[model samples]
Target: MGSGISKARRGLLYISYNGKVQKFMFDRKATSRDIQEQLAISCGLTRLSNVILKCRGDVIAISPSMPNNTPQEPYTLEQAGYNVSANDIIASTVKEIGKQFRQAFMVEETKREVYNRVASIESRVEKDGKRLMEMEKYKLDLVELRDAIYNKQTNTLDYNRLRPAITLPNHFYCPSTEQESLISMARDIPAYNKYVLTNETKEALKTPQFDVWQWEPNEMLILLEEMYFELGLVDELDIHPATLKRFLLRVQENYRNNPFHNFRHCFCVTQMMYVLIHGCRLQEVLSKRDICVLLTACICHDLDHPGFNNTYQINSRSELAVRYNDMSPLENHHCAVSFKILSSPECNIFANLTPEEFKEVRGDMIILILATDMARHAEILDAFKQKLDNFDYSSEDHLNTLKMILIKACDISNECRPIQVSEGWVECLMEEYFHQSDQEKKECLPVAPFMDRDRVTKPTAQIGFIKYVLLPLFEALNKLYPEVEFIALESLKQALNHYERMKDFDENKKKLFAGPVMSKSGRDWYSEKQMVDEGGQ
Candidate 1:
């Protein structure tokens, strides 16, 4: 063996096996198999012959030790590249072993806690997935119910049970073929084609014609297009031209072919609204809210008019009068019917507006349109007249009253047109009144004033209307907008002068009177316009 060193000196080797530690006893004389035999007895896992033992990563050799005392030979475990001593068991004590065991126990405890936390998270995710599936099913049920309520593909609405919220059933706008054709005509108007729009369009609006019977539908559409583009409404409102056309056409079709309160009359009122806003520079005085209200009210004010006055509806006990409790029946009907059209997505020109924006438009539009009832004419005129000197533009009520006057002025703007236009509209109005008279006669109801064809002639009727209705309204409007006042005064004076001359020509006295041709339609066309044929002779 070795010279001075004892080969039988023992040392404790702490072996790390799997996730555990064990202490093995070894001597300088022990071979690798000797360590394996210890491992087999302790762990029952080292019975294999191929097992090798290592201390601190270097292999322990089984061969004979180095012959005694070479000066370079390893003399201790430290010199042999292992930090071990004969007293290693005492230094690396049971206390150190207990600390390592506790550390291992804590690691296993941490792993179990982490696994349980992951399982809880997975359970929550599963519950959320089920809830999401339930919500999806509910949404599908709503869609199915909507589809069953209205068939958007068929372009048919269940009008009997229509709710405002589901106006067009999923916002689908489908125009009927006929409505589409009419809508096409609406887009053909001269949109900003200044050169294309005849001087008649500009002049008729400026010196406006009195007789509107000759004003055809094509001219009206062009004027509307001119107004829309001029106001930049197409861009500002994000309007689809075809959709606007559908709305306009729909409104037109709804207007009965009555002689005065007809589609042509609506066109006239709309045009006058355009003139008032643009010509009077009201476009500057009002906000976009005011402008939209005034313009839209003018277009829809006369919707579903029954060619009869409110009093007549009340007296005749008409359904409309009953529905509205006989107060402003026609005006209320107009507002209701117009909203019904607007409720349709195909005709809702204001669909692009937000709910709040639309609500504002709706409130103002109702106010402006309801002001057109002639029964409220005195109330409307007097209210504005009282507010003229102390008018506060910032005050909502004051501004609303002003807007009422504006829409009313547009309503009777026919009286402010040139002699022919004023005379023509009078004829249309008289014809409507006479038709109402006829209905009253058939129903055995008492005829209203100025509506009796037998009693109230055109000259007397128009003169009375101009003096009592147009004069008071326009005179008040003049104080607010002088530019508008000049034309209204001039046209009204001219029409009154003519009607004043013809006041003597009763039904029997007109046989001798001769007048100029009013239209190519012959005697009947000028029959109402032709006055004082016999002159002052």
Candidate 2:
């Protein structure tokens, strides 16, 4: 029992030589002398007790009775004869560790692959959505192009003769592509091509062919195509391809003569309609369908006008005016003629519309066409302003917004059109008005404003018309459509400038007519007159 070794008030040691086991119990406080005394007796090293005590805390102290056997040597845990080295141990552990790390890396790689695959799928879905949107946009563009072409062809058609045929290709086509294709196809129709080429030459030459050349059906179609292609791009309004082709054919049959409602006028109106729709941002107010209907109305609003106003027809007691009771007589006749043509099974451009949609479209068409009467312009604008002021735009019912803006925009579209286009229209209208004036003069009837045949130019009347009528109407429209303000302002400015220039002309004329020769020196003339008066007396 290692001489019952004990450390003074610090620790106690117990050694069992029989079992080769040792036990130690530490004290909370012990001195170095206690450990020296215990080790000296327990290890039987009295002579080297001091040396053993010096190494005490450095090495684990064992009682001599607990460790009297030979020192045990360490052996490899693996098969000893197999000659396993420290490097082998390290290599084996590294391989196991590497295997775990590789497994973890594989899991991370798999997760990354899955994540990448999901991302690829999401990207594809986004691309597909964009492609679908683009396809829909193209379809709409195609529809609009088709409608424009149809309206142009229809207005050019001669109603008295055979109806012009407009063949629409079924395949998807862009306007530019279709135009190029049509130009190529034109070559096959030799007579049609010759007529178009000749007409083109005449226009280029600025020849007076209006009264001389009769408009052929194919020639009319070609012109329609040209006008349809010329209008700027519009996104919202979409005209059905079939409807457009059929409408053109019907128009050709309905207005065969070079009537007052010619294709050129329709083209101008259609172009104006596009400007109004886009320039006003009317899409914010109106539906795409409503816009389409409005455009259609613009094209056919003055159809079969007979180159005369209601007043003329009423004064002449024309059958059509009499039949319609002389109230918007020309407009009424035009609407009836257009709707009648539309009612025909073969001429129904709006055939594809549902009953409700058709009703709305027909109603909108009637409203717009009737509103085009210059006499109604003031009343219509008043009503439009009242609606604009009273109506709440935030209301859930967007229909009112649609009606108000569409009607207002159409009524004043001419004021916002390009200067060149507006000027062209003014000239055409002036020519028409003058022609009516001439007829009225021959009949000994009262001439109205521009319709006065005796008037040299009626520039004052022109200025008055723009200042009082056109400017006010456009100013109201500009409030609703700010983008068109610049255009309308420019147009008004140009018109007013022209009026001022014309007024100056009138002033200069007065000065020329009232020459200095007409008046002698004031005092000298009076003196000469006095002598003649005295002689007479």
Q: State every prediction's TM-score relative to the real structure.
A: 0.57, 0.51
Candidate 1 lDDT by residue in tens digits, 307-374? 77887889978777777898888888788777878887877878898999999889888888888887
Worst 10 contiguous positions by lDDT, candidate 1: 165-174
TM-score, candidate 2, is 0.51
Residue range 1-537, candidate 2, lDDT tens digits: 543435443344443322343443434244544544454444443422342311222343433322222113211111112233765899999999999999999999999999999999998998789789979989998776656555455665343332121122222112333422321211122222343345554343221112212445556555444333333212222344444555665554444233234665564455455555555665577566665666667667766556667788888777766677878877776677678667756556677778887887787788667767777766666766765555555663335434544554554444344344455555555666777788888887767866665664646766776788777776776666676566466767776786679789998987654553356567356445655777733
At residue 173, candidate 2 shows an lDDT of 13
Error of 1 at 456 (Å): 1.3
Q: What lDDT would each prediction earn against the true structure? A: 0.69, 0.55
Angstrom error at residue 417, model 2:
4.3
How does residue 443 of candidate 2 score in lDDT? Answer: 89
What lDDT is reached at residue 390 by model 2?
53
Residue 460, candidate 1: alpha-carbon lDDT? 83
